[model samples]
Target: MTRRTENLAGRALMAAFCLAVLVPFAGIVLAALHPPGSVVPGLSWPQHPTLESFTRAWSDAGFGGLLRNSAVIALGVVPLALVCASLAGYAFATMTFRGRKVLFGFLMLGLALPYEAAVVPLYYDLRAIGLTDTPLALILALTGLFMPFGAFWMREQFLALPKEMTEAASIDGAGSWTVLWRVLLPCSRPALITLGLLYFLWAWNQFLLSLILIQNPAGRTAPAGLGFFVGAHNIDVPLLSAATLIVIGPVVAVYLFFQRHFIAGMLAGAVKG
Candidate 1:
């Protein structure tokens, strides 16, 4: 097709794609505010909207504790994952040693082994280590679970760097660690931020691991706590919806603020790979 025709088609396709993605979120927002009886009565716009549901979801449902737990888990997971990914990525990209391919292949395998398979082993391991029902346990598990993808993605970014840059730094008598921190990382901001954001979203949404590891309500993350909010005794649909939206609010805000950065980083990493 001609360039103009291709451009027109692409724009049309993207507009449709945007509508497809946004319509569901709009529905959720509407439902969050609609009257209590309206969820199944029929879809309609919210009128005489009130945030009482949001307030109750925040306070009465004990969502505050869950929110705090999620924040702590994410805070801990992000830093630890960044450290592990950075080191592993630099090693895979720049350092050459025996069994390097074999080791990296093992790491790649982690990406495929679904965590459900490991939950039993992890539970036993946590029990053995006396970490069950603890925020630390959740943080540790999340860090380990995400490491493989984080390292793999970061390795692509590091490898895409021109070797000439590192070589020049070395010629100036800089050590490998120094060169990596000072020269390579400054150029890889997009990759680091992209990975951080992805890791945050994953840790935030993880319910299975949290559900299995955290039996205590105080330690439960937001998603699992939402499950508790909808119970046989009381199913407050509007409040639940409001709480769910609040749980996802931060990630959505981050995406909106960094949409361009996110797209650029993801495309650059993919193209380089």
Candidate 2:
């Protein structure tokens, strides 16, 4: 195909995919604006839209507390996961020690083991330690579950760095830790930002682990509280829609800001590996 043909095809494909993704979000936005008793309603470019539901969901649902809990968990999880993963990843990539291969292999296996599989055991463990129903407990679980993916990806990123820089640093008598912190890490900013975003989104939206580890409604993340928004036999569709949009809005904004880097980060050096 010609260059123009390839470019045209790519633009069309991306436009189609963008529309596919946005349609549902458009539906939610419209639904949130629609009155409680509207009929034949399904996102028809509302003639009369309002923020009435969003304001009510926040005011009535005690969304303030839920937002606080979610924020605390996300804050703790992101830094903890990043620091731990960077340390482990740097060790795997730059250090030559006994059993390093075996240890790194085990870390990779964490990615395969479904986290839901061990929720029961985790509950017992946390309960034994008296950490259940606490934000700390949820943070620990998010960090433990999320650290592995970051470690594996970061190790690959560090390994893919120019060896000559490390050699140069070592020739100048810099230690391994110094070389990692001052040299390679400074150069891996994109990978770090990308990984941080992933951790934040996952930890922010995490429900299953939060449900098992945190028993209190106040301790639960916003996504989990959506379940309690309605009775068993009745549904509060507008409030639920508003809550859904609120919970997701921050993460969506984060993605929109870093979207240019997302595709590049995801596909970075994939074919070579």
Candidate 3:
């Protein structure tokens, strides 16, 4: 095809994809703007759109507590996961040790394992340890569950760096920790930011683990709380839509805030690979 033809085709394809995503989202927004308990059929615009559904949903769903719980879990998971992933990635990428390959291979097995298959066993195990029904249980589980991918991503990023950077740091009398914290980390900001965003998003949106592990309504994550809210308000489309938007608001805000770095990190990884 000619260059102009290819450009036009690509633009058209992009627009199609954008509409595919935005159309459903726009429908939800419109539905939410209708009065609470109103039947919003097929994305019809409300004649008198109001934010009443949002307020009612927030109060009815106890979203303040739900969002707080989600934040707490996400905050707990992100730092712990990042620390473990970075350390493991650094060791795997830059160090030589026995059983390294075996260890990495074993860790990678987690990527292939279905988390659902382990949920029942995990519940029993955590119950035995008196950790079930607590935020800590979910936090720890999410951190561990995220480790395999986190480590793999960090390892690729570290491996793509020039060996001379580490060598120079070593010659400058920098220890492993110093080289990691001071030298390498500064260069890996995009990767770290991207990974942290992913961790936060996953932790915030983790419904199954939150639902299964945390029984206390007071400690339920936003997504888990939303599930209950959905069940209770199944017939209220506007209120349900409003509640759904509230649950996902933080994730959308975070992505928008870090859009540049996330895109850069993804592009960097793609080029390196």
**Model 2: residues with Cα > 4 Å off, grouped in runs:** 230-234, 260-264, 267-273
C-alpha lDDT values of all predictions: 0.85, 0.82, 0.93
Regions of model 1 farther than 4 Å from truth:
37-41, 232-236
lDDT of 2 by residue, 141-194 (tens): 888998789888889899888899999999999997899899988877778888
Tens digits of lDDT, candidate 3, 200-246: 99999999988899898888999999999999999999999999999
lDDT score, candidate 3, position 4? 100
Q: Compared to the true structure, candidate 3 yields what TM-score?
A: 0.97
Ranked candidates (lDDT, high to low): 3, 1, 2
Of candidates 2 and 1, the better by lDDT: 1
In model 1, which residue pairs have backbone atoms overlapping below 3 Å?
none
Best by lDDT: 3
State the lDDT of candidate 1 residue by residue for 1-273, as single tens digits: 999999999999999999998887776677678655444233567667767667767886687778888888988899999989999999999999999999999999999988899998999999898999998999999999998998898888988988899999999999989988999988888888888888888999998999999999878898888877776215656766787898898778877887887888888787876
